[model samples]
Target: MVSFKEIKNDLPAGIVVFLVAVPLCLGIAMASGAPLFSGIIAGFVGGIVVTLISGSQLGVSGPAAGLAVIVLHAIEGLGSYEVFLSAVVLAGAFQLALGFLKAGSIGYYFPSSVIKGMLSGIGVIIILKQIPHAFGYDESYEGSLHFMEPDGKTTFSLLFDAIRYVSPAAVIISGLSLAILIFWEQILSKKGKIFQIIQGPLVVVILGIVLNLLFLNVYPEMALSANHLVELPVADSLGGFFQQFTAPDFSRVLTYEVLFLAGTLAIVASLETLLCLEATDKLDPYKRISPANRELKAQGVGNIVSGLLGGLPVTQVIVRSSANIQSGGRTKLSALIHGVLILGSVIAIPGLLNMIPLASLAAILIVVGYKLAKPALFKSMYRGGWNQFLPFVVTVLAIVFTDLLTGIGIGMVVGIFFILKNSYHVSHTMLTEKTPAGKEKYRMVLAEEVTFLNKGNIMQTLRKIPANAELEIDMSRSAVVDPDVRELIEDYKNTARSNNIKLSIKETAEDEKLEYEGMKF
Candidate 1:
């Protein structure tokens, strides 16, 4: 059972998480072509609704960055943003089916190296993506997807634009906020338990807002624009509350294009959620296992809520989960409280939040990215084995050059390569026997599930077997053999006549061949 001590310990962390999430929720929504309010809705559902059903104690769910590309394309293809909400609802239904079918186990098949690489790759991307925004260079929106200028300008061109066009107020606020966040960790944490207990990110957010307000009032001309802060839909009364709900254009959802978009969202969202869940569990402080199937169900529920309320699809996010762990979270209550805090802040203190600078949020993400790409992470994987390193590197490179799915697919291939490479090394054996009668003997055995890769080993073993011997072959426990292995065995049998060996099968049957044929490749 979860303890109150854990809950109490998590309060400070929850507050920090809420602060970090607020801007991100809005930024991701903005990037996805959805209304800013939709991001808040997703954050709320992820924190409150998803946490209730999730098996993970620390993982926090929200609108995922990985879905940005898909969401962007979907919105454009669907003609209207409201029409895409129907796809979101259908995607949630698909995820629910995946949970019931216990498909979450698929996450376990990913190699540790590949997962680590993916995380690191994503970390680098986050840092790169946020560089412009952190400096208060708000060009082409906060979360721009296209590497090249949307209008054919290069990345260097965009950087030039930012340098020339950045607002003085935004630069000052961002610089100051980043400075405070940096110093807060170094100075405050050394003071006492209470100071250390409070997260640096939270301190930065609070200070950023205060600074914004002070700057705005004192020097209105030099102040950052209203766009810098989170834009929440503040509702003062009952009627205003109901107006927030965004209804779906269900009439257009049955179109072929809509159906394809729904399928894409369902598959990608489920995959990314499961991936985050798996990675987060590995990073858990207590080394506990989370129920992936349950996570899927919870995420499905969250997506449904988000879809109905004009929010994007939700997924378990590693950034917030790691922050939850780092911030001393002991239970899922931290996540629940964060959700409450999000709703309360938007309703009661949006004016206060509006003071926060985008750079401050970028500072938090930079730190998160560093944690995922820590030097020790690579060292640890190397010490574990090369089997892990190859896939991990492949995943990282693939993600950096391509996208999430492409990177993961490449990593999987590298992982399979290692698996087969390892298998071939220990999978076959040939023995030579000596008898008083001067009749040489040989024994050959092939491992179960032998593939073509194992042929070299099998042939090498066969070549060492003595001639003029009574040969005994073992296939009793072997399940399946590749065509290469069959060819090797048949070749050996044919050559036995010249070798003067009496070949005998220790175990063989017609049924065995049929069973082997039925086995998976």
Candidate 2:
């Protein structure tokens, strides 16, 4: 069933995605307060295991930045990293149940405003967290998403601290890396087939290793310290490499706290995967629609394998999926190949990988972050109107100040408020007209559906009707009217008679024309 043409298209794309994923996996693991190797393991499981079962052709799964905050706290609260692994296992089981129950449709309920806000919020967090790493300040965690740092400094304050302790060597490497990345993307990448095959991030990383090595040899004083470089765990033999894999501790599986955390992870991961699935499908060149339920099932299996192998929790990451698309990945083979490459590199040349400096990776992420939170996106959202812009801005701010889940919660609330306001305003259309006889006539046209959300507006409209005026209540277009609204109409009818106002009701065949004169509740 496999074709050579497909491989030709996918292999190069896979290599590009692999290049993009390596540093992200390592950085996210560092951010989550987990062992660095666990990130690679998760990337392996996400690519090799999940891609095999996923319905999505281009969605690449890996450790997500959105989960970094939760993972950090879960590890701290659970008392050990292994216990958190147990929670991840349980979370996979939860996802499996969700898939079986066909709960993947829940993602459809989230507004586009909220989703965009989430993306922008995560982008801002990525840029803020990577600043110190970019300048070669390695005191803080590499992938942290929180504003408050473990060193008693806030995210903004850390910038000042990083400047005070700036490393000139790191600055130079990062500057050159960024320049190369920009040059490759803007000029060389468009000029030839070779540039298309060779990714800019890959070139930047390789060049960074070479430059740092040069600094070490030519100017010993400018050489970066070990802390400024990647630190992959080395294994001398195949058996020693196998020793790196860790299993989850099952002793904490029955604890209520563990179960609660597991449920939390499951809900969050599932939502994130579904959102990414929707986003990735939009970016597909063929406009392919991935099956949400199947994707959930695949993610559940991936997390189970990852947790068993001492990996962090996995989700469909938008960043990697977008990279896969941009790199011309045509199928799941690209993701699978990337995973195999990760395994091979770790096994064969981890020493070479270790030569990479954190500054180069930081430069790569800063570019990624800027793409996510581009100024044009904000301006476009603002032009869409207040109904769209309010929730978007609020979600971005909340996620920046708080955490992901909390920010989403706040955004959802704001989105709901806007929905309620629109519902109230759209319940009916009121018009006043003057006839040739100099008599005033009022017409109130009910909307297609009137629910309790329109109660206040309906009451306000009724109260504003002038006494002794002609009024017509129209419902011919309405398909459904709430019982509360019916009661309000009945009360208005009685009040109309008492106020000596002319009142008439127009109804459709679907509506009940109730005679409520002198009717008791």
Candidate 3:
């Protein structure tokens, strides 16, 4: 059952997550080349829609940075943004099916170490990707893929370019915003009670908006354009608001291209959502487990709503989730309230939002990225052993060099190999006793799974058996008895004859050859 105490503890985190999610939601949409409103719509729906069905107490879902690449291609491949939105609607339906089928158990198969590595990897990626944006270089897309080259400029190259042609406006805003954020965390948080209640990021964001407004008023030529602001498609009245829905191109739904687009979106979005869910659960202070299936259903709903409203695909996001947890978010209400705030901002304060400089948001994201890719994360994984560290490092490298899906797939393969290795090494042992009778009474028991992997151990145990004694070989409870192990048992039976030992075999499934005179060494 849900508790009010839990909700109370989560309030602060939820607000923090809201502040972080807003800019991210906007930035990701911009990076994807989709409508900025699409990102906000995704964030709003993820918070309000997904929260209704989510099992997680503190997890906050929204437009994920990981989906930026997929969304960008999807918009292009589908040929029209409207057509692509239809595909998103269908993708949500598919996710709903996955939830109903109870496929969420797959989440449990992932090792904790691999999941941790993935979270940290995402954090590192966020920082690396946001460096140019933080420096006011907008050439490269925000939340770009690992190998993606935007406008013929590499991520690293753009950083150098930004440094060469640094915008004094961007520099001042970002620096001031970062300074305020830092000091807000260090000083104001430790000051009086009321000040501490107001988080540093919130204050920085507000101050950034005010600063930009002041710049616009005084130095209009130096001010950033409205294009840089969080643009919400607002209508003048309630009737206009009702007309804001974007209908999907249903005619294209049956086309092969649309199907392909839908499939790609479904797979990538699902992967990102699940990964974020896993990461969020790990960061949960109370260590609550989220029902993966339920999360899928909720995300599906959010996507459907977002797509219908011309929004980006939504997913459970780690940055927002972690911030939500860290800030003391307790209930889905926080997420819902965040969505309401987003809607209210779009409807009532688009101009005000435009006043906030992009660089300031970049600084916030940089901080978030650093927190995710902290040095302690590396040292902790290294100490956990190679089995843990290998997947962790590999995932990070793959993400850095490739894309999110590729990195996660590589990590999963490595994780599966570890599981198989452990499975092969498991020993199957059985103990037997003889009856206190002069007659050849025997008791038999078989190893757990007499597979080829256990052949050596089974052979050694058989060879050491005393001759000229009543012997019992048990196969009961054994799931698999390899042919080689059977051969060993046959050889043992035949060889024992020289010592006049009576051999008896007992198993749930009786094998004629291993049990009778037909037995051959």
Top-scoring candidate (lDDT): 2
Runs of candidate 3 exceeding 4 Å displacement: 1-15, 145-147, 179-192, 210-244, 428-521
lDDT, candidate 1, 368-417, per-residue tens: 77777788888888888889887887787777666677788899899999
Q: How good is model 1 by TM-score?
A: 0.86
Estimate, for each residue in 23-130, the C-alpha lDDT of model 2 and write its tens digit: 778878988889888999999899899999899999999898779978988898888998999999989989988898998888888888888888788778878877
Q: What C-alpha lDDT values do all the predictions have?
A: 0.77, 0.85, 0.72
Clashing residue pairs found in predicted model 2? none
| Residue clash pairs of candidate 3 | 10-328, 10-329, 10-330, 11-328, 12-327, 13-327, 13-328, 13-329, 14-329, 38-311
Better of 1 and 3 by TM-score: 1
The residue ranges of model 2 lying beyond 4 angstroms of the native Cα positions read 1-9, 326-328, 435-437, 509-521
List model 3 lDDT by residue over 78-186, tens digit each. Answer: 7798998999988888888888888777777777777877777777777776666566666655555565564665656776887886666667777887888777767
TM for candidate 3 is 0.81
